[model samples]
Target: MKPRSTGTANGCEWTSGTSPLLTIRGLCKSYGTNRVLDGVSLTVRPGRIVGLIGENGAGKSTLVKCILGLVPHDGGTIDRRATVAAIHQELSLAGGLSVTANLFLGRERRTRLGTLDHRTMQREAAAIFARLGVEIDPRAEVESLSVAQMQWVAIARALSAEARLLILDEPTALLNRDESTKLFTVLRALRGRGHAMLFISHKLDEVAALCDELIVLRDGVVVSSGTERLEPEEMARRMVGRELEALYPPRAVPQAGTVLRLEGAFGGSFELHVGEILGVAGLAGQGQADLGETLAGFRPLRSGGLTVQGRPVRFRSPRMARAAGIGYLAADRLRDGIWRDFTVAEHVGLGDLPRYTRRGHVQHAAIRSATERFIDTFQIRCRGPAALVGELSGGNQQKVSMAKVLGAEPQVVVFNEPTQGVDVGARQEIYSFIARLAARGVAVLLVSSDMQELIGLCRRVLVMRAGRIAGCVEEDPITEESLIYLATGVHGT
Candidate 1:
């Protein structure tokens, strides 16, 4: 069947002069009883950056998937005049392969004999790297590259495809301010070259600055679409279906009680204090991941002392850290968070099995009850506990990851970009959850490149520069300007 187009009267059109380069109309999709996309419609004109904003489960990803022919939409029409390229939230690069190999894997330049062209691919890969304003060794393995570098490589590969329409989903999540600015510069250059882009991001300020038009989705439907002239607050209200009084909740004054502390912490070179949510911010290469890994026991600290409740603690491994009442949630959920092949029940129950299992055997009934409780509590959209984690949406997958950590009941919860690709509503929910965790006296340490996320969720923000604590600011002093000043090493109040 021909897919139905979603660019009907219900759709938002930025231009009235001519037809768009790509048009979507009546896009409807569902998984059993769960209707993900309900007649969602949109349009993207040539040489325009179209911003797609929505709450979690608002059908943004589903719409993109349908356009990419990954998920078969129940009813939709996607009309396109040119080839489409997408940079998904999940890194699509093969981890085992080298950077150059992944970039030209399927679309490699070949000889008449149909063999792989190695020299040509490497040379072209280096040029692509140069174009992106970064110097990455083409021969280096993908596994060795940092998350931000890997993300750049993915974008370079997409650009190399010479696509007319490029879709970037949360492309700046892992990048620091400098790196992100460079990326924006590249994107603007692309826009100048008449490349139509569908930019999906949770950063409202970025959407306002970059996009020529805005399309907002809510509950799997197109609620608002217009020229990029609306106020950020207005745009957020439309996406979330409510007015937000304050983006960040009021920070509670830290009491004198001991929570968690690090004495002369020498992971690389930094010291962490109790009752502080240190905001580790830098240009992804500046040792943020290294610090997080060290804190989580994934990497060894050269010579450091970690303490909780005024007692010296030793965490040699992640298991040891968990045993010490410290929980670490990795930024890459697909790799370290959830077991994708496992069922939802299995995923949620994996961390809390000891609590449910009394004797040597496991308690299936107890596990089911616990999973159901988490699903209801978190408002997780899924078929059932029996459904595989891989089958769920990105938002739902993140919820599963959170459920696993929350089930463990740790004293200190270190969240590494908890809401990287999550939509607006899910972000709000996650923030609320984090606040509750703090209210319950669980020391929350968040490492996020997102300024708004750090400002909103954290009480006291410590800016990390070049693998050390540059400066610290309380909530009263926490503003975008101040955070950027510390992050970029500028002087400000």
Candidate 2:
């Protein structure tokens, strides 16, 4: 049977008369008592993009895992007729490996003498990057690259495999608008070439813009699936089973008191007032990472003095930053933020161990009680506080990260990409949570690549270019155009 065609992808017309590349029937998976996927079924056809969307803990990851054979399903059948590859939500590249080595990791080229062929691999790696229209050095180590560049590397690696069926999970979460547009162009090109893709993202607008079909999953079941195009609002409603509120909460007024101050640090100086959310924005790799790291105490400030609540202090570590009433929400939830092996209770209580501790001996009951409270307050979906953090979904993990930061009662917070991989419903919740923080007089420094996030939540945004403060925009209603022009140095109407 021919695949059903629906919406246009970018400018590419939907492909018709194509056979199914992959199919599943009655797919079910269970982790002990938790039913992650229940009777899920879907079809991916060649020359089309299928958008898989859902809320956190909605079995999207489990379905992907079962399809990739990373996990075994309880009862199901997944039929695959084409070569498959998956771009993970979390980066899966070897950090210590070079770009060239990572691209040719398992599928290595060797000379007739059975030795590794370095020249051919490097040449092919460069060619792949060129094909993707990204400028990346093949010799550079993956760990040395910035997060956006690393995401490009991951995409290039996936394309290098030349798989016909590609599964991408939250692929554009770390990418800025320009970068995302470029990537979408590339995906459109791939679709034109008859490659099938299962695109999983929490960004509803992206799903609407790029997919030929929409599949909505909630609570481990497919609630909506069709060939017709679904609007963002309809998709959000289906994913959460209710009418969704605005993605961003109403802004609060900032109090007139400087809560945190940095002078000449990382090529800029700024003061954060009480109850104010100051945004840091720019094209990727424009010193925003360094600024966030410095504020969070991961890196030392260079050529500047840091002050908190009128007290000059230097923080060489996170502990020192926390002691000085500062908290940080890292962009990379897997690496710098949450501990996968730690229990929810342990991770939440980690921010303020003293509250749950009594004279050096840890208080387990107190920790569990506090974590349970957070789970309820934040609406985190999991079995209990004792559940491993790794078992939680991406959005829930992010919620836990926010809980950990806010639970410490810090006067200032550095939130980097606070809603990177969260779904629409959870995004609203998080926006409200941050707004409440601002209402309570907490100073927030929001470092984000998502422009809407900066526009929606920040009172003043500092746009960076080439590791310096390029411009600052403080419009009553910030426009994406102003931020883009400042970020790219493009002077135009």
Candidate 3:
């Protein structure tokens, strides 16, 4: 094939293809009777970023595993000519160690006497960070750096091993808008330098913006593959095998009855009405997350109090909050929402075990039946209720988390970044689910950093800044400009 020349992103020259870095032909993988990947074929060439798009349980993760050699493929051949590395959604860097130490954890430089060579490691780490256009300090603790910086560190570690083909899985799931932009800039720079990348993301707009080519997977097969720039809607359609009409469902008019009210907390007072989708919006670390945590009883209110339907209450723990008809969907699903090792039945039953317990014994059959109901209701894709939560995709795991939350039958639900790492199809499903909750007279406090989510679905939005409610935007047509002004206090130029 002839090489295609693309304009330079930074200072490096960009050419399309030259001796494919990794090639897979007729790849097949399965888990017992269920086929995960079937006859999937793709090629990653240097100087190009390829987007691997798919819905939950569509075999994207399995293809990645097969490439990384984490799992043996059942059939087909993978002809790889270069070193490969992966950057997963969850970072693998040790928090207790310094950036340099974490980068060279397993492969450390050895001195003539065989002592730990901290100085040489720090020097090499600094060099890699500089090459990546990042300014992270090598001697700094990994935990002390920002999420975006840590991602850069992960990329640098991969590159330090002389890896030619890089696999990134949901790298921006934890980053804010600005942080994500910076990450994209660095990635483009890498592309300019002829580094092959397989970028897996649920955010289609991001894939549209960054990828030079698109490979859409559906139902364990490659449905579409091309270099043409496709719209997000078209990509979503190809991924799900249907046209997605709208991302956010129709908004419901909230009732006048107040379901939850907070007094002297979050530097102000706010009331959530029945069937209302009240949005809590702000920049990162600006007290919005704290507001969600406090409402869900993860933390104590310093001097204020909470009232559920006019009944004054102070919750000391999450269990206390649940007992008071409050449910919280944590932002970090893997860490707080769902347990990886636990089954779907166990997840739904752990929080509401009393409903299944009888005669001083936990009823396993009752829990399984209830879990199956949730599986159908949420459209969670899995073998059955006995499937481990870890084995499911990010979107399915999120569905299970939502099922666990709604199982408690709470009057007030606090959804923290409800679609953080979910795909477009699953995101729409979650939006409809939230709307249904509101239609059922359940109040929802949506704490999210996604501006479109705030504008698209919220009836009223409260913007927080510097540990206080900066302003409230209830006007019709709440735009991103208004939210940014309220969030950063930068009005007229």
Q: Indicate which candidate wins on TM-score.
A: 3
Can you write out model 1's per-residue Cα lDDT over 42-161, one digit (the tens) per residue? 888777999998876678888888888888889978777556788876788899999888888778888779888888999999998887678899999999988778988887787676
Q: Against the true structure, candidate 1 has what lDDT?
A: 0.77
Order by lDDT, highest first: 3, 2, 1
Candidate 1: TM-score?
0.86
lDDT of each: 0.77, 0.86, 0.89
Candidate 2 off by > 4 Å: 1-17, 119-162, 266-268
- Model 2 TM-score is 0.90
Candidate 2: residue pairs that collide: none
Model 3 lDDT per residue over 1-493, tens place: 0122223433223334687878899999999999989999998899889999998889988898888888999999987666688899999889999999888878899899999988998899999988888899999999999888899989988887767789999999889888899899989999898898999999899999999999999999999998988999899999999878788988868998998888887778889999999999998889998999988899998878789989999889989999999999999998999999999999999868888899989999999999999999999989899999999988999999999988889999999999998888999999999999999999999999998998889979999999999878987888888899999999946
TM-scores of the candidates are 0.86, 0.90, 0.95
Cα RMSD, model 2: 5.2
Give, for candidate 2, the lowest lDDT window spanning 10 residues. 1-10
* lDDT minimum window of 10 residues, candidate 1: 1-10
